[model samples]
Target: MQGLAQVPRLLLSYAGVQFEDYHYENPDHWFKEDKLHLGLDFPNLPYLVDGEYNITESGAIQRYIIDRWGPAELLGKDAKEKAKLESFLSIFTEIAGAAKGLFFNKEWETAKTAVIEKYRPKLEQLDKFVGENKFVLGYLTLADFVVAEDSHYIERLFPEDFKAFSFLGRIRAEFNDLPQIKKYYEQPKAFKGRFFPEYAAVTIEQ
Candidate 1:
């Protein structure tokens, strides 16, 4: 459970969005109430229940929030910016999706190192794409939020190998430099970093 799930919280916070948060950690029981207001089933742990609409997929959930609450910066102003942002985020999201299965592996028999080597190129591509850019798009936006969350976790898994992809290192440095990104990331209490047990577990293993 990396803070990858906290992307929306950061994006929305940065966009000055304030709303109630409903959580059902590993809600396997599927005990969500009737599909009325925000009609979402609790079966999906991270489902976003927004006024009779429950979006199970993480990307859709995040983008919808941006499209509605943050019509400008979070998404983009014009077609070019929005398209670029979307392409960038889509690629980055794929990287994260592909990396997670390996990054999250508990196997220690050279599997982790092998996985790192395999995904190093993906990380590099991400780095090169975001090189020297203050944000994913022309400015701070949802793309940055998503990538930051993904990298924050991936770095924890392969800090040293991460440096091998110099671009990733740059991206990491960039996010660290952004006061607003850091501030927005730290604003929401429930989605805190370094405190989550998943993070602690990673540390303990390290």
Candidate 2:
């Protein structure tokens, strides 16, 4: 629901890894269906189902996949690095919480000021952390994927309004410009029934 699958898809593709992506419209009883299918008692998404195993949380899914299929080794070769990678992913799970509240929660519809207030500090901190890094870990890794996914979704939500968040704006540009990620975007294979909200008001900077 947070459009977070972008990171997993792009990471898997960039590393020449193969994975299945499932997409379908929200059923009439969305939460109810999720519980029966994925054991999702809470409303969340961008989950994965591998054969008989059903996984719902994004962090759990990412770590599980990385552990199963080794690539650039975003989880690190040592015990410490692996732990840090998981820690970074956890941080983003929190960061996206604010974005989700603003963009997805209907209860916060008229609370734009409150939403901005919540997001401003988070963005400032992220901007500082991502600075001067060619990619997370100084190479393409899960940490980069963590930030890339959100930047991608944010740009998609309001494609040209990222200037207010300059570092994030640059991150989004770099992500789309990456050759592998560009390829994934060109051939997303998005399921026909995927959600496509009507064009909202989007501002583009010249």
Candidate 3:
């Protein structure tokens, strides 16, 4: 299963860049030990250590990967496309945060309906934006990876509603078909089990 935090790794894998895939199984190990020792300005999960660069935050890590080891077009071709990419990224982040809130607040059972209703219109808008395009923004961009990973959470936790999202499904299929991604999936990796961390009250595996 691909976790939302694994988005940067997915981008690196797609670019065929070699990187260490580290997993912290125990929360205490991170919060009590490694988090304190790592020289990161904001110690956090999914931080990337590339030479002298130590970056935290998933979005920043993702952009770094794209800029450093890129199929440069992933950043978008022009200013307009870049702005659209950022818009999609912002929406994707909103969706991911909402999903995390369900478990973080321990309101999955109670808040599920409102969560679905709130995001359905947003997803519908995204669907129209994507329409028949091969990718979001009409080309492959980092937002595609972000949306693809976030969609899995919706599919698993809100399957009944997610079924209507043919555009999302199409983008996901296209993402999986990429040669680098196909190769990445074939290799053994540690990103498995629940989508959220163990502390979360609710979990989903896809």
Candidate 4:
């Protein structure tokens, strides 16, 4: 599934790096058969095996790809800027955690209003943070890919909620319009894999 893997996938595509995009149809089977032999102390789904280096954790994988294949400007012009970018990226986990409650609620219709009310303020705050910038830091960076991918569930589940934040939509368009990224999305493989189908069903509803 794309899940956390999307961040690195998008970054790698944007960087024009040739890489394997493996998806697990049955994660339990894969874990039992393959994970134990991987030699990683902390084996996890969405892991990256590049050359002799095997990396786990989505964030670490994203940074490694960016450092190795992406432009230096993707990190930032200097240390302070990079730190600030990281701070913004860190907020994504909180946003995703909050949205997950809404996505997985068994009584979604009953819970939707309250969930939206609780998260709307935070979403507005993010809108302000994004402001008029083309990307999170006014340029394409790992932060853009990470934050955008994490927030994608929310955008699909609540289009009106995101429409209120015009900058968010613009950023999405900008990211999708990237030639390499555009090509990747056109592939059928991009849409394959299980990723919260119940949530997707809810999203597709009128």
The top-ranked prediction according to TM-score is: 3
Off by over 4 Å in 3: none
| Candidate 4 local lDDT, 12-115, one digit each (tens) | 87788877787767767677876888777688877899888899987788888889897777888789889888777666567666666666666766767776
Write down the TM-score of every candidate: 0.72, 0.68, 0.90, 0.84
Superposed by TM-score, candidate 2 places the C-alpha of residue 67 at a distance from the truth, in angstroms, of 1.3
* Rank ordering of all candidates by lDDT, starting from the highest: 3, 4, 1, 2
Alpha-carbon lDDT, every model: 0.62, 0.59, 0.79, 0.73
lDDT of candidate 3 over 61-161, digit per residue (tens): 88888899988889899888889888877876787678768766676877878987898888788778888998997778887787777777677667776
- Which candidate should be chosen as best, given lDDT against the real structure? 3
Per-residue lDDT of model 2, residues 74-94, tens digit only: 777678776766665666557
Model 4 clash count equals: 0
TM-score rank, highest first?
3, 4, 1, 2
